[model samples]
Target: MTESLNISIQFGGGAELLFDKIKKREVDLPALKKYLPDCQREKWTIRELLLWIKENLLREREELFLQGDSVRPGILVLINDADWELCGELDYELQNRDTIMFISTLHGG
Candidate 1:
């Protein structure tokens, strides 16, 4: 049987504008092995989550949300209400029911 991860995603600090003005969503992510055939890891990480968001959720201005493979400089990432940096950044493994939030610190002039 294939396993799936159910998690919460939130966008704030105007970041929701990039995601069709939606502030929160519940998502079901397929197993890494099934989602990415080349993936050797058994679990999903923040790195893969970013790619998933870009492909499935992000509406436009991808440059404002992603920088290379990670979030842009002005965006803050939180996993389960804690800073992503404290959770190993891109290497952080995702857990079922985890809450991931993206907040844009950049403001328009």
Candidate 2:
């Protein structure tokens, strides 16, 4: 049987605008070796997941959602309800059924 990583991704605080107003999505990501041949890592990390999301899930205006190799400066990331900063940020390894949320800190008053 093929192994899959199931995760829930969410957007809020105006971040949904970049995802076509879709606030939540369930994704089943193929194993790292199955999808990414150039990658040397076995486990999926937030860094890899961000790239995956940019390639697969992001619908439009990627600039509003990302900057360089990570989320734009004003965005906040959460992993399973805990601040991703405390969870190793981009180095955090993703787990099956993990919940990841991106919230944009920029919004009009």
Clashing pairs in 1: none
Model 2 residue 18 distance off true place after TM-score fit, in angstroms: 0.9
TM-score of each: 0.97, 0.94
Candidate 2 residue lDDT tens string, 1-109: 1488999999999899888889999999999988888888888999999999999888898988889889998899999999999999999999999999999998767
Error of 1 at 10 (Å): 0.3
lDDT tens digits, residue span 1-109, model 1: 2699999999999999999999999999997888898987889999999999999999999999999999999999999999999999999999999999999999989
lDDT of 2 at 96: 93
Model 1 / residue 26 / CA error / Å: 0.2
* lDDT scores of the candidates, listed in order: 0.95, 0.92
What's the residue-level lDDT of 66 in candidate 2? 86
- lDDT (Cα, 0-100) at 103 in candidate 1: 95
